[model samples]
Target: MENHALKSWPDVAPKLVAVAAGRAPADTVLKGGAWVNVHTREVLENHDIAIAEGRFAYCGPDASHCIGPDTQVIDCAGQYMIPGLCDAHMHIESGMLTPAEFARAVAPHGTTSMFTDPHEIANVMGLEGVRLMHDEALLQPINIFTQMPSCAPSAPGLETTGFEITPDDVAEAMTWPGIIGLGEMMNFPGVVNADPKMLAEIAATQRAGKAVGGHYASPDLGPAFHAYAAGGPADDHEGTCEADAIARTRQGMRHMMRLGSAWYDVETQITAVTEKGLDPRNFILCTDDCHSGTLVNDGHMNRVVRHAIECGCDPLIALQMATINTATHFGLERELGSISPGRRADVILTSDLGTLPIHRVIARGVTVAIEGEMKVDCPHLDWPAHARDTVHMGRALSGADFEIAAPAGANHVTANVIGVVENQAPTKALKAELKVQDGLVPGDPEQDVCQIALVERHQATGGVVNAFVSGFGYTGQMAMASTVAHDSHHMIVVGTSHADMALAANRLQEVGGGVTIWKDGKELALVELPIAGLMSDAPATEVAAKADKMVQAMEACGCTLNNAYMQHSLLALVVIPELRISDLGLVDVRTFELTPLFDEGQDQ
Candidate 1:
């Protein structure tokens, strides 16, 4: 089917006017519902909405005049008719499903719009990968705007990606048909330092009159912060505190508070508006990165909206944050985010506003979903073999491949460990005193310290950078490996036993690419993601079930953190926080430089 759903408003204007004026029948009319007027922040009862040509023709107290024999009338029956939810920022690959499957999973939950950054795929497959994602996204019934990735490595010079995005890439992508803007500018330091390439990318986006997604992950609200603001990003989602929210909004940037699968940044930052009384319009709700289980078992934007309400935000205010605020941030206020005339016919029927039970979802003049059932087909793309075959571990890895050798004659060593903060992206640059065993450093399970390895997958060269990490509470002979390592998309293996770690990493390579957990030298669970080694071609439900098993396997290994698998995947991400592992070495993200694993004064 053709996706004329997002066609120009003028193309549908005549049909809409005919239906609005009672001259012609509407395609669909939703009657007897309490309309959520986001424009006025009020709910008007006994309202009817007329839809024609995939757009809202009229929304008012009465639409009986436009109803004809063929016009399908949905009886809302006193249900609250709210605008379809919009995700301001997210990654489709995070769901571990292709765009088609992701859309199918969320449509039942009332999410009709998504502004997704294909940066993960871009990191693995470059511009061609992004185009593949974009093409599939446009085929969905809902809005899934593609943002050209501004940073492929996320932190250039700190991490290397299989494919690097250049300024020319940004400029070229701005001209794509479905391109909305540039993806998150993850190279915040580059922007602050006036890096010519970074500046050129930002300038290209601005010149094309598109939004520039931001990622200022630093906590410093000083000169570096202001300099980043001046570098021309329109919105940011890396804020973790109330001050971070307030600072970005005060600087005319939209503060996006996200509640993803593992990231719980909304509670602290929403306080900026709830407690501090900052303008709610400057704040938006999003799910930056959610895995398949989170999208299927939990809701999408619906979940985020509920969390905001639980945080003392008024229900309508929370809805506004998810809908109009997001649409306005992306300059799509006129086209969506409300039950208004001339906008896309996207609405949700809920029994209650506070505890929103998405009873029905209408997108583009069609009832796409109802009562947790799909009423339409979300199209898919035939992924090529090149996309499927991505994992390239030059040779088979052994137990010695994960060994962290100590200095000569050292019995013990003080090493820097990447400490995982629960439910947050930032890691703590921690120090630990580890005993040397047979001239090798061993992870202390009692102290929650485990060995983490970054296996270079892009090149055939066998490169493994090992480091120590704390906070997973991993015990016994267990290892977790994934090719979905954030930003750079390398293979990350974290385990207490070198044998288990080697087995886990090789398992991923054997299956092309995916996440795997090993216990007692046996494969416990594996979620095969054959697409760029980042997303699976399987259905969302199947993927979610596999991901659930992965989580359970991690828990069985004595590691208990909410979505610990997500934390495991990001251990190799060298962009955010205090410390992280990379192909180069363990990077001190605070200093944006590689630091030595072993410190001075060891018992050598």
Candidate 2:
């Protein structure tokens, strides 16, 4: 296989010197542009950049001396030449596309670099799966640095996974060429409490001279948060409010404010820089999870930068948050994140500063995109057959499996419900009074209460753990089932009708794995993510088309939440607080314990 890793700066330094000294001709020269200097936070006009060996050789007022007869010169026409945007933290699988396809989709939006955590795949296929993601990431035209997944079963004892990422796995991944750091250490409690395994994994990454990502999902800024900070996580992206951002940066961690498809955190958190006057250098921008439809219709990191600006951030500061700040957080500032000499020649030409329009994009000295269209080919991996056949339901399910039997002739009960908050990651733990129907507790659509079941797909045990959920506004006999459940990657079915839920679950099992929606006992939409049941190998536009139909189907079922599919996928994420359902049982995340579904003592 061809190694797509870029040549080191030292390996090509002599050539760079020769080109800068006019001893050799440059391969390409971008002339007559306004440089957005991130290092000094200034826009200098009439700047020209010379490239050699896919690295910047000269960036000054004039590079005419480096230009030879054969050099390819492109006039920038006074466009704002900014460093190519970078996503500090993201997941390729969240796009429902493989690394190659995700890169192809975002490259056109001027995102030349991404630091992705492949933890989703690791939960399903283990180290081999992570290697597949890392190898494919190295083949892309843009930079896709892999973070070794630190938490497979994100909350160790709270949930079960197909595979567990051990300390040895973390050490082994550090040897890979594409690995940048350890992925977000979702096990915050483990770190704070000094669990040997979690500490060992962090130690291995630190010993290897890589960044250790953080995921302190709790809202508490008490001793626990401080202990987690003291445990050696260098950066965190789970901050949702200004206080969270302030606390993180105060503890010397980069605060990565994210704006993904469902996560709207930048607006509330960016105020730490915009209003409170915190140093902008300590704040970074990222998209923790954006699906294919968002990538195709909206933008990638470009969208984040624009959103930050819209949230009252200074244009130059927002650009820095997406570029130099991110690169610096990952210890990659010298290799990328700027248009400086010795850095990779990743630059974006845009006409505006605030409402940025991607006029052209250049990665590794190659023009990869123009006018919101891809200009270069992103290579794909030959996925094995085992990856496509991961859904193991043991046997076909029925309405009986989904039935929530009343506790020995009890007519009424106060049920613990998982409440979905719109455009947020956290859920509210709610209590609702539900009545029994024919010796079984039934979901009431009028009160917006619905049945949620976690069907264990990993072990094929055919185990179904039932609970209740609200805030989807779903009505009628509809059910939605997804194999892309977070952390555990089990099958999560939410519906008002047991039969439709059964139909949805069976449909996903039959198609290997993916998301399926059924209403009135008929299939409404299906976005088949056959690869490990997390992502598809299809093109972004194609997958996005199906995702659009899926969204329409959700709307038709009366779901009013923004990006309800993302909400559905995260119903099983035990790391986040309040309540969630897992293969084990209904999780009370605030206390990190399994709680019963019905509380018969409480009244409505």
Candidate 3:
């Protein structure tokens, strides 16, 4: 019923002619080129390729016999013809765009393939959300592979999701044409501990002969990591260092190095192949979460490829990581990934191997991107009604709602504070002494302490978790709030002033849902993400412009980090690290325990 390229596909006359004459179809022959062959791990000089029906008919020393008088051929002028790049692991929702728009944004970056996990949307909308994403992805011109989201709440019992994804969901999704594998098993602890739900999902993927993606965020690599590997996640992209890469690959897991808007992971981890001299085949490149800002400005897999080369990685090996390694990981090797015969004719023409200056991109034998702009229209999906109105802030909030009340008359008290590092995903669990004023836990400006609130938007149950945070560099009246909190999908609002916090939070709900910047009792900017209170349907450029404005607003508010909003959004994601905030309360992420908002001497 389905044309799984693994079996058979209808051949257009080109392949037959190539097979008969011992030459590939030159429907569009790229001549006078150097083929960067991932299979041979070498760049073959003076090569030619023939394309047919959006598939590579052949790539070798010659394609002359397949070229007819009607065949169109382009002279590469002796440039490097490389396979289109692939993002081994990523989240389409993380870009804050639908799959269709996300495709349009990255297609020009020579990223012909992507292995995406929609866990963010899954947390809010569950199986239906993932299904929508999967169905839409199949319509894209490029290879957009969807991974069945493994963790909906991410941590069962620790947090609650609007909808739950069961093993039945996983088993059913496996039959979909676009599903490549299971999404990152974020519940590594559950898997390692033999939790039935986690095991069931992994089992379904394995049973279906699909890969199980990994996300062991912890740096341990002790019994926990060993037990997790035993649980069967085939590849991991959470590694942030060379040693992390070494450990994952040594345990028979593909180490996926990522580079994104906020995450600078590739340069630090690629040394597994470059310096440690590990087998390059085990490495792959990814953009775990490329925000609209990154896709519009920085480039997608192209950025990773360029960064890998900067890290002293061999250009050929880097291409393999971005192409074949990714395809092979998701059981798509025979269908896509390379410039070999029978594969999707996804290729990029670049003048310099090291620089990776993408001059042209070809997908399925069709020229899609010439220079930097898209040359064709990427189709769109008719998103459902529920997907557009997911923000449900039960009631409006005032300054008092965000205030932290202290025990009767305690003067100075110790409290659990979230300490933000400069540009990392993890947070610091900090215990600090703070002063109390009028039966309230007052923030210490000297300690960079500011208020953080988690507004429960899922059920409109009127729940709010108030806490303290550092590293926003707030010096004046300002606040930032968004419903884009990861994993739990709550509204994370941070501010130096309670008045600004209340205003920012209420404004987001008024706009359905989105991030808002407020300073000096005035609203600075807004990016209306009507969908799930998390993403906007606006074009990538439109989203990027608003995001840039947000960055400027943060700068205006004296908050300084590479991408402070990205850092801000991660503050409530309890699964990743040391500290976080949830609708339940302040979370000690390492222990996954409920920490008191203020010191023991203070009130809850």
TM-score of 3: 0.96
Global CA lDDT computed for model 3:
0.85
lDDT of 2 by residue, 106-172 (tens): 9999999999999999999999999999999989999999999999899988899999999999999
**Candidate 2 ranges with C-alpha deviation above 4 Å:** 1-5, 600-604
- Tell me the RMSD of model 3 versus the true structure: 2.1
| Candidate 3 lDDT for residue 495 | 91
What TM-score do all the candidates reach, one by one? 0.99, 0.99, 0.96
Candidate with better lDDT, 2 vs 3: 2
lDDT of 1 by residue, 342-389 (tens): 999999999999889999999987889999899999888888889998
Q: Rank the candidates by lDDT, best first.
A: 2, 1, 3
For each candidate in the order shown, give its overall lDDT on alpha carbons.
Answer: 0.92, 0.94, 0.85
As for lDDT, the candidate ahead, 1 or 2, is: 2
Candidate 1: which stretches are off by over 4 Å? 1-6
- In candidate 1, position 377 carries an lDDT of 92
